[model samples]
Target: LSPADHLVVVRPNYATNIETPKAIGCAISYVDLDFDQGFAIDIEHVKAELRPNTKLISVTCPHNPTGTMMTRADLDALIALAEHHKCRLLVDETYRDLSYGERLPAAASLSPSAISVCSLSKAFGIPGIRIGWLLTRDPQLQETFLAAKEQIGICGSVIDEAIARATLERRDAFLASLLPEMARRRDIVQAWIDGETLVDWVRPQGGVVGFPRLNIDAGFDLDRFYTRLLEEHGAYVGPGHWFEMPKRFFRLGFGWPTEAELRGGLAAISAALRS
Candidate 1:
């Protein structure tokens, strides 16, 4: 749809998702998922925010930087709502494959109105290939998306395609080894956050990272605190402002570093706060 139509965006969401849409001049409205409810996005909020001219409703399942998973019931209701409203429901399922243990049903599979976008980068640890795909049952949207892809990249590399194919062929075996380790890392980070007095968070149900609320007061320049944490303390993290969140809320990427490195980094963060 054109930029003239209204779009509803999720707050504290991935920057590109929010900015790219706004950059193109789409009229924007926001629905913030609260941290206290484990970052749950209430359906009533969506109902209240829906407009007669609304063209798109965008959301992420197994949310980025927060690791919150939208319940199946909520997802189904959203699909039905989009159907009733005759608007597109775009669900970014990049992290769906990395769910703690259970398999998740793709939104597109349940409804023709659903648009599902996914990539192997975060889920399978294969970003170098840069392979991603979009799925939709709407022929017109599918045609439009293909046209957009053509304008951007005429095609992809054969070698990368072959590598991706090989990776997927062994997907089960690979994920078998990877998921448990991720769960371990997630737990470690959770335990560490639990012990910290300066921060509180809604632990992730699935996915690799989480957004933790820093206890800094309102009107404080979280940007300055984040800068010092990086420059003077030799610690780096995703500052909340980057996600269009308050300065006191920062993203904690708990799954990437090794156990020892994770512990060390957490200690460094703790030390920085103490100072």
Candidate 2:
């Protein structure tokens, strides 16, 4: 395979912390998505990035940090593009169940060209249970992925898998109870942001995270701001610079912390902003 074999990476991606050329790397041509546009993947841009040497195309739904989703039509277009180019499309649907509306169809379910990866992290709130899996119709690719795992071995604890399986068995019930609490926490954070004059963001459509930008025109230096917030207020918010955007943006986790703690953190952040 040529070193130039292009791998199209769609972002603001789930799991990716930033948005610059180096943030993604040269092996993969990064396709930028607009945060203001609900983080939709631009199909035309994706098409333009395709080369005969392109090997893989990857995407995330209920995207991390931004919490945006890929619509069904966009996904359909991606599948078509992959088939047309004879490339593989890797879809990370880790947060798929957390979406706001009818879930988009799994790309792997639609075609052999699509590969879907999922984990028990994020929405399941079980990072400790490091079990994740991929689904693909191609036996050869599946064998390849499994072979790669042998090199990595099964570092995931069996205990973790057992617990994760139980959680999966009760997934619907668990999410039904969890979603309300998460939604409430999200609302609290949104309200706090709305009241604050120093920050703003496009509201996330799904998932536990949101990326909000500090009022940069007001001379906000997010790196320093986050450092002071952590050191002085004992609060943590992910800096946007970590995700390759303007330093004004910071990632805020709404589902990870308890509502009370999230509120307190937001209050601390507001105080820091004022300072």
Candidate 3:
């Protein structure tokens, strides 16, 4: 999109979603998903934010940090809005293969005006390969996107392409081996949250991450909790500041760490809270 274009995006989104648009000098409107509402996207809120020049509406499924998934009806409404407004709808599906329930259809498949982007980075744990793709059914738009991609890098790396291909070839087997373990880890986190009054979460439906907030009043020493979590226990989390939220919220990942390490980290959170 051109510098003069307007973009509507979700707040507390993946950093690149906001950052890249800002870099392009696109005017942006943010539709914030609220904690009180379980971080679900309000379609009317999104529709209200659209401007005459809005070129794109950006969102994610199994969203980053919060790990909330959109219902199929909501997804359809978003696509319909984009179609009505003559703007592209960009759906980031990096974690699509990791769904804890029914997976929504790739948005691009349902609309010529929608774009779907996916990568092996999240679900396959292969960011080093640095491979991802964008999809659109519109021929003219596809050509424009291809021209822009060619200007940027000419083509993808041969080795990375080969590796990505091989990985996709066995994607089902990989997911089968991983999903059961992820479910167990997810259960462990749920049980911990159930037992703790110091913090609470919206309960992630999918993906490896969940954003939980500390249940503290004004007198709580929030800094001390973070300090003890790190220096005292060597545990780290994606701070809310990383997503432009208040420091009470943090992104906790349950997919990468071993079961022992995950339990240890959860325990550290408890100890740090008490300290």
Candidate 4:
């Protein structure tokens, strides 16, 4: 929370997770998720990074880029760890609503020490509204957050709030239509990965994205691949560097593109590879 405090972060994370703590000048440790391990985060790995001054531990569910989902038991363990250490656990649940199976309970609902963060930017595709919120059971903490918000700006746009409210009111109906389509797209992606010799991936459990690493052993020309993917095929992916990862890895998003576009993108990847 301060310059003298220690913060534990899960990586390779969204930029906000890394940048915010660095900006605060907090002594930081990273619990780096391993691609070989299916990007799994273990409680023991988290415990290893803990310092006595550790004030917050940050993690993501249905993680960005990798799209790995943590089990409910793992989440409970994280909350217990935070409680035992007398620290706070920040769970970024931005992609929680897009789960392929059962979704974990909101972290804040599980414990006063745990916080949940979410936005309409991801699942609902409404980033122009710039709406997001943090959840905490501690009233004092909530007040502290409001005070911080006051310092940043006068108030959020009324139009954005109204739109967000309307969206939330119809969330279930929206998701009911959206999720099945997401699953279909997800399957198409999975099938492409299964057949593609130039890449390998840990199948995403949820969310719109998957991190797939190019098989460098195949001697694929990555520089050409990117150039062709963009110039010739008119398709793009989030290069691994976007998430502070190796160049061999890339984030493929399935949620936004139309079915035809998704297939074209997959084909483009293959075409790029073959080139």
Q: Point to the candidate with the largest lDDT.
A: 3
- Candidate 3 lDDT over 146-206, as tens digits, reads 9989999988899999999999999999999888888789899999999999889988888
lDDT of each: 0.84, 0.80, 0.92, 0.91
Check candidate 1 and list the clashing pairs.
none
Superposed Cα deviation of residue 269, candidate 4 (Å): 0.7
Model 4, span 122-213: residue lDDT tens: 99999999999999999999999999999998799999999999999999999999999898898999899889998888888888999999
The whole-model C-alpha lDDT of candidate 4 against the native structure comes to 0.91
Over 1-275, each residue of candidate 2 has an lDDT whose tens digit, in order, gives 24556678886564442233234453667798676666778899999988878888878887777877777888899999999999988888888878766788777999999999888888888887678888999989889988889889856678987898899999999888887777778788889988988778778778889888777565556666778899999899877656666667778998877777888999998888767
Cα lDDT over the full model 3: 0.92
| Residue pairs whose backbone atoms clash in candidate 2 | 17-243, 18-243, 18-244, 19-243, 19-244
Rank the models by lDDT, top first.
Answer: 3, 4, 1, 2
lDDT of 4 at 275: 70
lDDT, model 1, position 119: 88
User: Candidate 2 or 4, higher TM-score?
Assistant: 4
Candidate 4 TM-score versus the reference: 0.97
- In model 4, which runs have C-alpha deviations exceeding 4 angstroms? 218-220
Taking the candidates one at a time, how many backbone clashes does each contain? 0, 5, 0, 0
Q: How many collisions between residues are there in candidate 4?
A: 0
